[model samples]
Target: MKVIDTVLNVLWLLLCGIWMALGYFLAGIVCCIFIITIPFGIASFRIAGYVLWPFGRTTVERPDAGAPSCVGNVIWLVFAGWWLVLAHIATAIALAVTIIGIPFAWANLKLIPISLMPLGREVVSTDEKFGGR
Candidate 1:
């Protein structure tokens, strides 16, 4: 990655990474406390990485070639994805209400489409995949 790309990715990872991790952590704790919910918790943990670094991730209709699929992924959407999407939507609405916050609100809204369907998305860098110049 170029210096600029590297720095931006780093900053993105930092800003959202911790928030994602915390969400997953709480989800995990909930699952652990109730053994029946462990599966859902684990699913949230998987999503946390994508949530944190969504900038580099791309969601596609199909997998690249061969990728693992899980039975719990759907459940994940039901339990966790909705919450994340709601949070972002609420944030977007709140920010849009203010002129100064319009930019931030736009950023939050940008996350919606991808956040809704994160499956099959690729997380890659310009140097690592098709993004290279």
Candidate 2:
């Protein structure tokens, strides 16, 4: 499974991961430019790494996340999250048109929620059970 993940990740990187990760990185940099949004910038950078090599990993909700996270996510959705969601959706649609790209398209769709609400989520290896943190 690890080897398969490696292969898929390499292919994904070649096909679209690099571009998606760059978009996240750009968003991070933009967010970091303002003093108030450093946390959102950090989340963007973290998600950028996940976008780069996503095959063997998954995102899980943090048990301790509370109302603050919800509020932050709402803010994110308004400012930047919607753009990321649209990018993922567009990428998915394009990938879905090719039979060989079906799995990648599915993966892109799976990423929408996390991209939309990155606050209070943790990225973990798929080997780790949710809440194992």
Output the number of the TM-score-best candidate: 2
lDDT of all predictions: 0.58, 0.93
* Cα error of candidate 2 at position 114, Å: 0.3
Q: Per-residue lDDT for 14 in model 1?
A: 56
Score residue 113 of candidate 2 by CA lDDT. Answer: 92
Q: What is the RMSD of candidate 2? A: 1.8
Off by over 4 Å in 2: 130-133
* lDDT of each residue in 1-133, candidate 1, tens digit only: 3565456546555545456456656766676677876655654555566556555444444455234434344555676667778877776676688786675467567766545545545445434466556
The regions of model 1 sitting more than 4 angstroms off are 1-21, 28-43, 53-71, 97-104, 119-122, 126-133
lDDT of 1: 0.58
- Cand. 2 Cα-lDDT: 0.93
